[model samples]
Target: MVTRRDLIRWLAAVPLFASIWPLLRLDDARAAQTPRRVRPGEPGWPTPSDWARLKQQVDGYLIRPESPLELCRESPDNAECLALFRELKNPYFIGDSPVLTQTCEWVGAWRAEPSAYVVAARRVEHVAAAVNFARERNLRVVVRGGGHSYLGTSNAPGSLMIWTRAMNEIRNHDAFVPSGCDGVIPPGPAVSVGAGAIWMHTYEAVTGGVGRYVQGGGCGTVGVAGLIQGGGFGTHSKQFGIASASLLEAEVVTADGAVRVVNARREPDLFWALKGGGGGTFGVVSRLTLRTHELPAVFGLVSCAVVARSDVAYERLLGRFVAFYADSLCNRHWGELATLLPGKRLRIDMSFQGLGKEEVATLWKPFWDWIGLQDDLTMMAAPSIVAGPGRLRWDGTARARFVPGLVVFDDRPGAPDANFFWASNLAEAGHVIHGFDSLWLPAAMLARERQPELVDALMGATRYWLVELHFQKGLAGAPADVIAAGLQTPVNPVVAESFALAIVASEGPPAFDGLTGHEPDVSKAQRDAKLIGLAINELGKVATAGGAYVAESSYFQKDWQAAYWGANYARLLSIKQRYDPHGVFFVRHGVGSEDWSDDGFTRMADSD
Candidate 1:
C-alpha cells in the first residue's frame, strides 16, 4: 500500500544515514540497528511522519489515551472529574477506557500508566499491522483486551499499545471443526469470540441466547482471552472443567506478522501452548473458539456467614465444616468459594448446578444441626439459598430477582441490559491491590486422618487474615472424563490432583502512585503483604505444592516458572523461542519473560 512518495517520507523521518539502507542487505541493515526498545523522546523514537503513516495504515484508529485521573488533578471539583471518579466504581466504564486498568496500583510494585500511542484495533489485520510496526521501529509493544490483569500486565507507559477493546465480536457454531481438522477432529458446538469480549457478554450470546454453556471465569467482567490463557475457573468448573481445556482453536498473529490458525490438528504444538501457555507470550490472539456443553437443568447458590464465640469453638467448627464438606459437598455438583475470616467467622458464598433448593438444604441440615448443638457458636447471617432454571442463571434480568445487590447492573445509558458484574467482585473494580497469594491443597487434606491438622492450619490462617478456598480452581473430585480432558492443558498438573486452591488476597480502592493524598500507603501495603504471606504459609504447612493459579498468584512469586506451569514450563519456553525468538511481545510473568529486563526494554544474555 506504500507509494514511492510515502516510502521517501518514511525514510525522511529516519536519521540521515538510514538513507543508505538501499545499498545494504536487509539482514545487514538490521544488524546495524540497536536492539533496545525505544520510548518517546528517546533516541530513534518514532517520528511524527512515521506515526502518521502507521495511523493511516490502521484506518486512523490510533489514539493517545490519557488517564482520567489527570483531570482529577486539573479540576478536582469539576463535574467531569467527579463523574469520572464515580464511573471508576463501575468495571464496564473502566474497561471501556484504554488508559485505565482494572487495577489502579499494586502495593510497592506497579501503577496504571498511559501508553504513548494506542492502536484501537478492530480487526486481525490491524493487530498484525501494529505488531509489524512496533517490531520494525524497536518500540515496546503492549496488548490489552479486558484490562483486568491484577499484575497490571496489560498497560505500560511510553509504549505502543494494541488496544483490542473495540474488537468484541461473538459468533456461534453448532458443529465447528477447526481448520485442517475436518474428518480428523470431529465437529463440536463452539463459540468464537474476539480478544476483547468479556465473559458477561460471551455468556449472554452462548448461554442466554442459546441454551448452552461455556466454562469461563467466575468474575463476569474478566476478558475471555486472558482467562483462557490463565486456566479459567468458574462456579460450575467441578462439572465442566477449566476454561483453557475447552479451547478448540485460536487465530493468532505471531511475532513475524504471520496470521496462524492454531488448533489440536494445525500447528499442534502452538495450539498446546495456547492452552494455558500465558497471553501475549506467544503472540497476539485475535479470536478464539471454545467448545461448549449442554446446559444443566438447574443452577443455585448458598449465601451465609457464621461466627464462633471462643477459640475452642472456632477450632471445633473448622473440624465440623471440613468433615461436612468432604461427606456432602465434595462432588462435582458443588463449586465457588467459602472464606475463613479473622474474627473466628466463616463466610459461605458457594454455587452449584443441578441441585434444587430443598435438596441442598437437606444436605446441609446435619451440619447446621451440629452447629446448633454447640455452646460457643453464633449465627452471623442465616443461610439464604436461591435455586432456579439453569438457563436463567446468566440472564441479567432473571438473576436480578435472586437476591438484592447480588449483581450490579451497568446502567449507563444505551448499554446492553445483559452487562452486569457480581456485587462481590465490586471491590476489585479500579482497586489497588496490596498482596495476593494462593496454592493448591491436595485432596488428601480432606481425609479423616488429616482433618485435625488441616483444621488447625485453617484456623491458624484466619488469625492473620481471611482465607478463601476456591473449589472450582481444583478438579480432584470431578468426573473422570473431565479430569482427563482438563489435564491435557499446560497448567500445573497439581490442579487435577488437588481438592481446592486456598487464596489469601487484599486490596483497596484506586490510589495512583505519586498522586498526593491519593497515593498508596507503602507502610500499610508492606504490612498487609507480610500478613498475607503469613496466612498462606499456614496452609503451606499442610500442602507443600509449589503449583499456583497463574492468573491470581503472587507477582513476586519465587520460582514462578515452576509455580505457574510446573513441568510444563520447559515446553512453553521452547515454543516461545521457536515462534517469537526475538521477543517482539513481552509481559511481566509471561513465559520467557525472564529473558528480558524488568521494563522489557532490554534483552538479557542468559536466555535459552
Candidate 2:
C-alpha cells in the first residue's frame, strides 16, 4: 500500500515531479500511472448539467463554451455572438475564444493565451461558487479586477479566470463602524466601493454625490480594488495619502470560498496584508470601505515649453526642478515637474488646494525666479483657466477634459500593436541628481547615437521613451516611526521615504512580417530587445537601495522581491502561508510566486 508520506518522499526525490506533487493524492497518483492534461468539455470539466446546477446556486448567469455568447475565432462577427457580446453587462473571453484575442490585450508582451474557462462573477455568491468549483476540479484560478496587470499577472494559461468587472457597485456610508470594533471607530465620511468598480465610476459617485474625493488612480479605467491593494498613487496622494492608507475595511473571499470581513479589529494580520500586498495574491476582495475627504477648491497652473538648448542648460534646469521638489517635500504641496529630452522641454503643472491666486503666486515665486535667470527658456501656460466647483469633474463623460487638466497621460500608446518595457525607481531627496545623471542622461544619449532609427520609430509611433519625475510629499510631516508604523503593509517602504519617483520606459511595435504570416521577424525582435535592454540597464542604476514601485516596474527585474516589497516580503510570505497554504492564488512576480515559471507551471520551492 502506497501511503501519502511514501508518495511525498518519492516525489521529493525528483525535482521535475514537484509541480504535480501538491495536487495529487497517494491513491490517485498510484491509480493513474501518469497525470494527463484535462481539456474543456472532458470528464474533468464541468458538464452542461453541472453548470446548470451552479447557475441556480448563484445570483449570476453561467456561460458555457458552446453558448451563443462564446466568442468564436473562425466566425468572429457571428450575429448571435455579437448580440450576446453587446448584451453582456461585463464580459471577458477564455483562451482560444475569438473575443479573447481582443480582450486579452493587457500588456502586449505578457498576454496569456489561456485554455481554461472564464467566469464573469456578478455577486459574492457567484465568486464563492466559482472558487469551490475550481477547487473540486483541481484547477488553478486567476482573478481579474480591471485586467490591467502589466506583467500579465491577472490571467494564467489553462487556468480558470474569475472576472469581477460585473461586480462594480459604489455606495457611501457616512460615519459607519465595523461590527467587531475593540475601540472607538474613526469618524468622518467613508465610501464602500465594490472590487470591480473603476476609478472613474467611484470618482464620479463620491465627488459628485457626496462632494468628496478619495486618493485614487489618475486613469479613469483603473480598478479601485487592484490599485488600492497595490498601494495606489495619484494627484491627490500627496495630500490624502496612498489609496490603501485610507482603507477602513474589506470583504475578502479566501481560498476556501469563505467570505471574511477584515479590518484592524478583525483579522488584523489579513487587514495589514490586504492594504499594500500586490493584488490577486492574498484573496479576492469583494468590497472595500475607504475614508473620503471633502473636495477642496483650488487654483492651478499648467505650463510647458522647450527650455534647454545645451546639455549644460538641461542639467541646470533638472537641478532647479530637483531643488524645487526637495523644497516641496518639506512644505506640503501638490505638483509635478517633468522634462522630455530630444526637445529638451520642461513642463510644470501645479495645484494649490484652497489657496487664492495671490497665495498660489507667492508659493510659486521661487520657481518663477529661477526661470527668470534663464534667458533661452520660455513658458507657455494654458488659457481659459478658472477656479471653482465646476472646475473639478470626475465623471466618464468629462474624462477627456479633466485628464489633460491633471496632466494625466497614458503611458501605453498604440497599445494592441505595440509592447513597452518600463522601470520605476524611488529617488531620495539627496539622490535625485544622481538618479538623473546615472540613468536618464546616458539612455537619452544612447538612443540618439546608437539607435537613431529605433528612436525615430518610437517617437513617430508611440512617443516611446520618457523619464518622468513625480513629486509627492504626503509623508514629509510624519516622523520615521509614524511612517514605519504604516510600513506594516506590503508596499515598498521607499515610496513613503522618497521625494520623487523616476520612471524610465520604452516601447517597441510588433515585429511581424506580413509575408511570414504572423511569425515575428527575428532581426526586428532582436533590435527592439537590444534597445529595451539598454533602457532597463540604465534605469536599474537609478533605482535607490530602498526599493521600486510595483505598478510601473520591469517584470524582469533581478531583485524584484526586494524592489517591490523590501523588508515586508517575509511577513507577506508568512501571511500567505497562513491564509493560502495550498498556494491557490498565484501570479507571476507575486508573493511565493518565485516557485512558478513564466508559463504558469508550478515548481516547489526548496524550503517546501
Candidate 3:
C-alpha cells in the first residue's frame, strides 16, 4: 500500500502543485477555470478547400491568430482559432484547461511568452504540410518536438510552433538490426525511429530484440528529434557516444518547408552541422535513423562512501573522480562519479562489457587506492548488465527513474592541467561533480531519513552507472586546451550546438522586495542591475577558473553563445540562412532572435 509520505512526495512532485501550494489549496481558484466541453461531430477533418483557403489567408511571417480561430469552429467556448482545428481530431494535451498566459513557463519562477503554439501534428505529411504552410506564409517557425525546452524556444508567442508529439513511430527495418531474443545477433540490422520518438521508446526498440542501438539521455521522456539535434547525453555515452553519433539519417523539413532526406553521404554539410550544431536553428526533423551498438555482458560498479560534503571529503572524492573520468575519456568508456552533498556520499558508476571482479578492481584501483578501501570492503557485484533484451521487462518503475536536467561535461584526461591555464578551479574546488552529484542530494537525503526502507532498497541495485558519451569524427580531435576548458563547463562541441534553454522562473520578475516577499518598483532597475552584476561576477570567476557557464541549464544568458555553442555561431547562421532564407524558422533566444538573444549574448560578450 502506498503510504501518506509517498502521497506527499507525489504531490510535491506534481507539475502544477509542487511549485504553487497556496494556489492549489484554493478550491475557488480551481473552480474558476473549468474544462470546456468539445462539441460533437465537429467535422471529421478539413476539406481541401478549407486547407487551401487557410493557406492563402495566412500571409505574413507571423502567427495567424485569426486563421487559427477560423480553422476551428467559432464559439464562445473556445478562443479565435484557425479552421485547421476542425481537421485535427486529436485531443488537446494540456496540464490544465484554461491555457496559462505563458506556454514557455518552466520550473523555478520565470514566465516567458512564446510566439505561438501549433496544435500537435501526428502524420509525416501533416508535418510537411505545416512546414510548407508556415514557410509560404513567411511565418517564423519553431517545432515543438517534446515541449521540454528549458530555454522556452520550443513554443513561441507569435511564431508558428510545430509540435511533433503525435509523430512518434518505431520500427525495425530489415536493413537495420534484426529483431530477436536468442541471446545472439542476426544477419539483418534494422532500425526505424520516428521524429517524435522519445529516448525511452527508442531504447525499447533498440535494446528489445537482441540488438542494441546507440542513443543518449537517461531520461525516457525527451523527444529523440530534439535530443539528437541538441547533442544528447546519457548513462551509456561512454561505450557509444552522443545520440547524434549514432544517427544514420534524418528526414528534415527545411526552412522553406521542403522535406529532404539528409545523412553523412547526402548533404554532408547539413549532416555535419546537425550532429552538434543544436536544435531550432536548423529545420524541423521528421524522423531519425540511429546506429546500434553491442551490449555488454556484466556491467561492473563500486561505491567508496555515502557522501562527500566536507572539504577533505570533497577533495578526496572529487580529485579521484576527475582522475578517473580523465582516464575514462581516453578509453572512450564515459564513466560518471557523483558526489552527493546533502547525504555526504561519494559514488562512482563505471561501465565495462562483460568484465569480472578482477578487471573491475584493476580499472577502479586508482579510486580504491585514493579512498583506501580494503580487500574485505563491502563490494556488491551483480551479473546484471543494464543493456540487453530482458531490460525491457524491468517494469514501468524503471522507466520513471529517467529524469532530465542531468548536467554532463567533457572532463577527460589532461583536463585539469588545461584548466590550470584558464584558471578554471572547479576541478580544484571539487564543484565539477556530475549532474547527479549536484541534484539528487536533497531528495536522497529526504528519502533516507524519511524512508529508510526505500533508500536501502535502492542502495546498490545496479552494478555499473550507464556511462553515456558520443564523439563525432572531427570532434574527437578538438584541441586539448578547448577540451580542457569545455570539460570544466558543459559547453562542448556537442552541447554547444543545441538549444539548451535554461528557464529562470522565480516567484516573480526582478523587483525590490521590501520584506513582504514583494519587491518595490522604485529601485527595480538599479536592484536588477546590481543583482545581474553580482551573478556575472560569480560566472566570470567560474570562467576564469578554467570552468565555464551553461545557459541551457541556467535560464540567464549572461555568456550564452560563447559559453554554450563555442565558435559555432557563424556556421549555425550560415546553415540557418541556407535552409530558411525567409527566416521562416524563428525562436526566442534562438540563433538570430533579438528580443531574447540581445541581452544574453551581448551582455556576456561585453562583460568580457
Candidate 4:
C-alpha cells in the first residue's frame, strides 16, 4: 500500500510536479484544533503581499473574478450586457466564465455569486498552490469546474475559488492499468479526461473520433469531475452503469497540498470516497480515467406527446405507459426521461441505445393502438422515433448530418465547432430555479398489482407541478453486471433497486442579482416552490424509500446524508476525516460538514 506520506514523497520526486508548495503539515495534535475561518476584510485575512506571493507561485494564473452581470447591473440596455444575455443561454459560455454558474439561482436559497479571487487553474500545481494558500490562511476555499452545483457549493461570495475551467484536455487510451495495480487489475481501454472537460467534448473525442462509448451526463455541459464525484447517470446508464462506477483512477490535489493518484490500489479509501462521495467535499480532482465501452450500432430518440381530453383518460394513459415500461422498456436499451405534465399531458422525450428505428416503432405500436381506443385521449404528436448510427449521437460535427436542429452550437468567436449543447437542455441554461427535488421511485411500484398506486401518485403530483421520470438515473432493470458495478459506489443504495428517479421542479429566466426589471419574480417563485414541494410530497407517499441524487436535490433536504449516501455516509465520513483532518475541504451537506456552519465559515462543534 502507498501510504499518504509515501504518496507525498512520490509527488515531490516527479520533476514535472515537484512539491509546488511545502505541504501544510498538520500534525495529529494541531489537526484537532479548529481555526476560525476568515473572509476578506477580516482580522485573519491574508494581506495583499500574501496573495501576491501565492499568485507568483502559480505563475500568474490567479485572477480576480468579475461577474458579467455587473455590466447588466450598471445599464440593462447596454450593448455589452445585451450581448452577454445572448450568450448567457449558451451553457458552453456559462461553463467558461469564472463568475457564472450553470444554475444561476435557486429561489429562497442562493444566487450564483463570484468569489473574491479565482485561481484559474490549468494544472495540478496551480490547484495545489491554491489549496496550500487557503489552508494556511484559514480562508474558505470553493472549487468550481462545471459550476453546475444546484446547492451553490461551487460558489461563495467572499472565498477563494480553484477554477479548473482551463484544465480541459481529453485523451483516449487503448489500455489502462491503475498505479500499483499492474498485476492486481488487468489493463483495459479507457479515457483520461481533465476535470474541466464536459460530456460534450468527452463524447466527441471518445465516440465520434475513436468509435468507442464513455458513460457521461445526458446534458453535455455537466463537468466531468463533479458528476463522477456525485454519482453520475446518463441516457444509457442502464447499459453500462453510473459514470462513477467506471472510474479507474483519479489524480486529486488533497487538502494537504499533496498531488496524489488514487484508485482501487493506492489510497483505496479515498478512491472509494471519490466514487459517489459528493463533489467539492474531498479534494480537487484534476483528472480522471474511466473504462470505456464499445459503441452500440444505434443510438436513438422517441419524442412525442399524448394529451388526454379527460381526467379518467389520463389515468389510463399513465397506467398503460407504466406497464409498458416495466414489460419492455426497462432494459439497457431504454433510458432517459418521460414527463407527465399539467393539462393531462404525457410527454415522451426518451432515448434508446442498440435499437433500430423500425424496432422502436414496432414496440410502441401496441401502446399507440391502446391510446386510439380511448375517446378522451388525443395523440398530439405523430410517432417521431429516429434512430441513427450510435457514434453520431454526441458528435456535434456529425450529428447535424443525421439529427438536425436537435443541438445548438457555440457560435462565439474562436469557439470550437464541436462546442454545442442539446436543444432540450437550453431551457436550463442560466435559468433561475424556482424549486427542484429528485427522489428514486422504487421498482415495486411497477408491479401489476401496484400500478394503480403509482398512477394515483403521478396523477395527484402533476396537479401541483410537472413530474419527470428519469429512467437512466436508476438501476432497477439494468444488466446484473451493471447493477453489481453500481453497488460499489457510495451513492444512495436505493438507486440500484429503483425503476426511475422522479424529478419535480420549476425555474425562470436568468435573474442576475442587482439587475432591475430582470430580477426573478420572488412572489411567483415562492408560489411555484410551494407547489413543487406539494408534488414531491404526493410522490413521497409511495416512494417507499428516502433517497435523492445529491447533485439534483433540494437545499432544504432534512436528512441529506442518508438521502444522498444512505448507509455509506459513515464510511465516507471516516475517510473524509482521515484525508482532510484539518477541515480544508468543506462543502454544504458533505461528509464531516455537520461540524461546520452552513456557510462553511465557522466551526459548529469541537473534535467531532
Point to the candidate with the largest TM-score: 4
Provide the overall lDDT of each model, using Cα atoms, as 2-decimal numbers.
Answer: 0.87, 0.58, 0.43, 0.89
**Which lDDT tens digits does candidate 3 get at residues 150-181?**
55555444445666666778876655532232
Candidate 4: Cα lDDT at 252: 97
In order, what is each prediction's RMSD in angstroms? 6.7, 9.7, 20.6, 6.4
Residue ranges of candidate 3 with Cα displaced over 4 Å? 1-117, 138-140, 176-190, 300-310, 324-330, 340-354, 361-551, 594-608
Candidate 1 residue lDDT tens string, 1-608: 88544565577567885866465445444544546789899989988999999999999999988777877785567787768767888999989999998898798788888999999999999999999999999889998999999887988888999988888999999999999988998988999999999999998899887889999998999999999987778878889998988999999999999999999978999999888988888899999999999998898888788899889988998888888888888789999888998889988888888778899999888888777788888888987788888788788887778667778988799988888998889898989889999989998888999999999889878889999999888998899988998889998998888889999998887777876546777788889999998999898899887678888888888899999899999999999989998889998878988878888998766342
Estimate, for each residue in 68-116, the C-alpha lDDT of model 2 and write its tens digit.
3334344546775454333321222221231232222222255435435
RMSD of 2: 9.7
Per-residue alpha-carbon lDDT of model 4 for 1-608, expressed as tens digits? 88655665676677866445255234423544665799889897889899899889889998888877877776788888888887889998888899888888887898777899999998899999999999998889999999888888879888999999888999999979999999889989899999999888898899887899999899899999999999989889999999999999999999999999999989999999999998888999999999999999998889889999888989989999999999999998989989999899999988998888988999999988888888898989976888888767777767776777888998888998889888889989889888889889999998899999999999999999999999999999999999999999999889999989999989898886557857888998899999999999999999969799999899988899999999999999999988898789999889989889888998876663
Stretches > 4 Å off in candidate 4:
1-34
